[model samples]
Target: MNTHAMVMALALLISSAHLHAQDTVVIDGAVTDRHGKAVPLCDVIFNPSGFIADDSLYFKCDANGRYRAEIPAGHYNSLYSLDLPQYAKTQLEFWGWNLQLTENQTIDIAFDTIEVYSLAVWASNGGSQSLFAAFRPMHLAAAKLPRLYYKNVDGTPKAIMDISPTLTKSDIQASIDGEPVVLIDFHWSYEHAGQCSAGKDSPFSENEPCYMPMIIAQFHKPKLAPGKHLLRVRIQDHLSKEIGEGVTHFSSNSMGLGF
Candidate 1:
């Protein structure tokens, strides 16, 4: 081969080798609360910040909120699924630091805890329909609120609201006599000046204290008969903070509420 041709061929081979090395990077990360407590079962989602609309990469934290995912070596916006329906949307920002995934990188995500002010269950509208409940969360000021948007739903909006809290990343469950009961739906709202607005509607006025509303888990089966029933409620925040809890006597005729 001629000298000039040999030099060009060698340069091309080196460039190709570098490109191949760039494509083999992996990402390892751990999800934890701000206090260093592990956040288990949290979804770790990777969104490409580039023009290419690639499908988001999804992974989950283990029982200790640790996760590992192999990445294709690119810049991405890491998002953690930290469920905080009661705080202002801005205050609930769960995005991690921007990630530039190179060769076998490691990133750690830390989230703060959410506050649960109160929790209660009641029979609204004369109890003809299923049961309803309310959980009041601590509100965030406007400057720190997150943006709220709408998404499509499959069934009745009421049912969707009732079931949301049950599906939270935290372990939230209600059972009777060691038997599990189906939570039909989940709902949430925001409270300001004694008036509550649906969470989906955002941009609250900055004049008053606005709080994220609590999740109300509804029950349609294993009827809450008119007698003594032990009601237990527990809630943990992103940082493993037990922000809300309740253990009280419930009766069909009582306005069920315990802090």
Candidate 2:
């Protein structure tokens, strides 16, 4: 855990604590893999955007990978993550999205195998913090993604810090049907340097860009045959010296979205 990482995480946690008392919108959804298999007990984190101040919302999926989140009516972003220590780190998948929540909504998110993986370190307390995301494509070129899911050693909910700059195209590689594709064009997003920008540059530096700590990438539903198609993600992080590589098999029904 790096001291700067812990400081940054704490700062983001403090800033996301601004609670609002007003009408709220309810979000109900399921967390499933690309194959429509439920990912139970996963964590879903929500942070509404475009508000004077915002609070972080947390939810947990049941055995069927179903969860409900209540948040103020506003534009919001959510991250879905499942931490199954039993599986290889490279096998884990995480997902995130940005959307408006003016009323009750039902958004189902899907999970894809991890192509690249990263973690932030809290040097002050020696804790490793990371956000992992996965995605499954839908019929209308849309997707089902998971929310940010992480907990403290004390079993308390933790907010994810914006650190998206640490990841680059070079760190990830993907191929569809053996045809290489652009990494940046697939589900990549950054956090703005706002109130969450504190401690992003240096431990106590005043000027620095604060991007969200999570890295999101996805493969949209591509037109393929009705048989098995291969989706591969090769990840190499120069900074962490950690490599994540895996292959996922997806199937299509000619006209339907395949996982």
User: Which candidate leads in TM-score?
Assistant: 2
TM-score of 2: 0.36
Cα RMSDs, all models: 21.0, 21.4
Best by lDDT: 1
Q: Residue by residue across 45-143, what tens digits does model 1's lDDT show? A: 666663224677777778877788876886554434453452345333244323445557555555443333334455454554554555543323322
Query: Alpha-carbon error at 80 in model 2, in Å?
Result: 2.9
Which window of ten consecutive residues has the lowest lDDT sum in model 2? 137-146
Give the TM-score comparing model 1 with the true structure, all chains together.
0.35
Which 10 consecutive residues of model 1 have the lowest summed lDDT?
156-165
Model 1: lDDT of residue 95: 46
**What would the TM-scores of all predictions be?**
0.35, 0.36
